[model samples]
Target: MPPPNALQLLQSIFGYEQFRGRQADIVSHVANGGDALVLMPTGGGKSLCYQIPALMRDGCAVVVSPLIALMQDQVEGLHQLGIDAAFLNSTQTLDETRDVERRFMSGSLKLLYVAPERLLTPRFMGLMESGPVSLFAIDEAHCVSQWGHDFRPEYIGLSVLHERFPTVPRIALTATADALTRAEIVKRLALENAAEFVSSFDRPNIRYRIVEKDNARKQLLDFIEREHDGDVGIVYCLSRKRVEDTAQFLCDNGITALPYHAGLSSDVRARNQTRFLREDGIVMVATIAFGMGIDKPDVRFVAHIDLPKSLEGYYQETGRAGRDGLPSNAWLAYGLNDVMQLKEMIENGQAPEAQKQVERQKLSAMLGLAETVACRRQTILAYFGETSAPCGNCDNCLSPPKTWDATEAARKALSCVFRTGQRFGAGHIIDVLLGKRTDKVEMHLHDQVSTFGIGKDMPEAAWRSVLRQLLAGGYLQTEPEFGGLQLTDLARPLLRGELSVQLRGLPEKKRERAERGQKRSAASLDIAPADDALWQALRSKRRALADAQAVPAYLIFSDATLKAMLDAKPATLAEMAHISGVGAQKLERYGLEFLDVLHAS
Candidate 1:
């Protein structure tokens, strides 16, 4: 069989017709003993770059994944494809671990998934010495960088893989990495000479929307009721308590919602996560702890109740939705409070001053995106060093917001901060500006200050907006000790009337167009309405098979494959082999049954 080339293995085993983007080049490069560092987006078929190489190589490929759940999921998916895969992690018993080790030594498995901590152990190192290892695949390679959002200390020790087995090819893959993180990955992974494959970071299918937070819970409810009813989505909150509260709120209002956070019991979290992945129309309300290894392809929306800490975190979190290449949404509600809270956290954290500075810059970029009146998609991609035309699907492109020359207003807000002795936070400052002669203001004698009541022309929200923009734009700074707002060096220009500031006004709520290319009509996909029953029956059958095997339904056949089968209406097993995702093994195993369903329909 000429040793089964990369494309051939991709089609015959994985059942995909062709490699996506640079997947073929990556597979062949690694298969031929070339190192690679791949910076591809989520849902960009990153797994195939290494999975195909694992099949084409001589020995089992070892994948270092961060989470045990991720390993189990990938192993189950591989098993359904009739591939021999296994993992060694704490979840397995001692005997089970030893058995996987034996299989790896004997070359019985094509791929072996391990955690970084376990892979660096003495026992595993000994097993590596006894085997003819194929290559090393470092998944989520961004974890190696200290500056990355999901940094793991254990990942720092993985560079020994290259030091020990210099001949074995290594491939590092990450879904999100800025310029700094990419350089750090190359240095830490010892892949300085590896072929760098940087794919497009744009997820055009996701319509980005950032709304001003007002009656936040009501606003979230309105968004869900309007666009994402009865669809699978993820709502991200900043804290565990918020996750629980949001989940309860959603369930109370008749939405199927579940909470996932580090505070929950392991059993409860696992159960909730399993229910979310296996079932349909489940909205997982989670903190940042969740969604790292989730492979669900049908998430319709990702909503943020509060602002994320950085652009990288925001990008990664929002990337979880629309993995099926369908039109989805990334909606966020942020306001001055979000900025204040995040600044407080970062300022008080124990990280070194240098790291804090970097975080401030990243947060500032994220805030800029939130306040941008231009295309949200362009702003996101520009942050990642990619350029794109304005995507008309985003909120700003669909309905642009108005901007006002708030230079005078900004000066007034900064003066309020300065005149208040730089001791009071934004709330008190806003009160003084709005001419509120409250007890706190009177007690502090802020009402008697020259800046007090001078800003009565602008509304309270508008003033807050101006203050937040000043902070984000580096014209003001927050004191973590007392949550006080102070002027920064950058504010000198604006304070001295040397620089002008412009603030974006909140956009009026507009009727959003129906999400484009979200759901393909049966007729459009070549499946007649009369055949809908049969198509659903096929899905039901696949689900039953998956449940019987205790695996994800996608492992049996992805939604794309089922759609292809529905559209093609193959009459026999031989004809089914021509489907995009139908490999020889799948065709032989269940193709006849699918053909039978089509014939009956």
Candidate 2:
């Protein structure tokens, strides 16, 4: 039943025993010059949606990717499968780019990777005219939608590919896209006629957990100390400052940590990034700036110290974990401030009110996912408009969450917010709950309120839970400038006793969870540790180097590089220079220090 050339190329290059899922059908449709819109999850082999078609077609397929590193990885992956491929980016040298262009001019190149901006160039347009573009693969095609999580101004230029080359088969691919984004991708790419394929969004291998925000630093430490110790992963923070501080604190506490962000020079970003990719047992702390195009396969876990911009953003960032098909953890902690911060940002941005409102709704849904008692996998999948039964793999399914009766506690917590005119934070509210009469509470005469001492039966911990649930439920909204709470229309109903508020089930102590032990093992170190202590010494050296440079530690060689060095035990700077990320500049600058550390250890 397989069509001409489709069956041949699939086995020749992919070597798969059989096409997984609807891959064969999609490939067959596109091989016949049909357009495609694919929604496969990470590691679902989405690349084949366009790859097989490129192999069977007449001219080179142009793959538009957002990240330079990702383009390299995809091109490398294609070449590993014995397919001829090349990428054009800032990383490629003049001669290298010229040579790749040489292949394209000869009609010998099967695939070419290009950034959206580069593809829209007059020079690139002329190149397209010279050689036929049999297929166009738009990777992360959601970026073209202004409403999508990772919008790029460059992607708006992609509309031209179809406008100019009306006959070339185009396949737009993304790991995550909601219904709105899906529609936008179609309109933006002019793929209205494109065949649609949406794979299940369920990441069955990941367990999702959201803890209440109090003692967040301690709680995070406690969780990682027990379950994810010495694992190479990513910790996401809300701000550049937090990213830097958390990375430093983790280093001080005996964990190998590095900071990454856009503020740092690109050289440092690339150096740290290379370490993360090529090294093992290294943890990188970053803001939203870090996840796109990251290709590390065994990221054991992803922890967020603050909320993301949207559920789509959160899912894509967390998807970076468990890409190697192993069990991994996705943990986060947030409270009322995260809500106010997100809301305030939207309210203050320049976009149309409709876009801001849409963003707000998306963020609220994400908060619901964090607080919901339903299966995390089901909740996340539903957000993407895909329905699934309980996965029995996430924290929710394994725990089968149980709720508590907090009716009296809810009223008291609301009472404090109501009496104080919603003008204080959690600490002040906690004081009134236990009748502590703290300086701020007494200063405001909140100690005399009848709500005071009424909440004594409930532990301060329980009051904290009640307040978070109420905020997430929309019963309360934080006033950013006033730095306090204000009752929403939702709260008036609850306050007048017109509505009864029900709280979701709470998480157990981190250790009580079934996945309490580490999901990562040493074999994940693709480069076996010739010397275990070498990584530790390399980290120590990185800290000193970062301090001396007044840059984030990751600006030095990353945990990935140190691991790669340890694995290969390269004895010279020349060999280290051959690594993917290190260039002549870094090899000359930091190479000796790392080599000395490796040798000394």
TM-score of each: 0.94, 0.83
Instruction: List candidate 2 segments past 4 Å from native.
Output: 1-4, 510-601
For candidate 2, give the lDDT: 0.77
What is the C-alpha lDDT profile of model 1 across 1-601, one tens digit per residue?
A: 4556887888788787788888988988999999999988888889989988898889999999998866887888777678899998988888998899889988999999999999999888888978978999999999999999999999999999988899999999999999999999999999999999999998878878888888777778877877777778899999999999999999999999999999999889888888887776899999988998788887888999999998999999999887767677888998888998899999999999999999988899999999888999999999999999998778788767788898899888888899999978889999999999999999999989999899888888787888878877878888889779988898888889998977887554433334323322210234468878987799888888778877767677776688888878888787799887788888887888788778877
Question: Candidate 2 has which clashing residue pairs, if any?
Answer: 275-560, 275-561, 279-560
Alpha carbon RMSD to native, model 2: 8.2
Q: Global CA lDDT of candidate 1, please?
A: 0.86
Local accuracy of candidate 2 as per-residue lDDT tens digits, 507-527: 666645444643334113443
lDDT score of residue 589 within candidate 1: 78
Candidate closest to the true structure, highest TM-score? 1
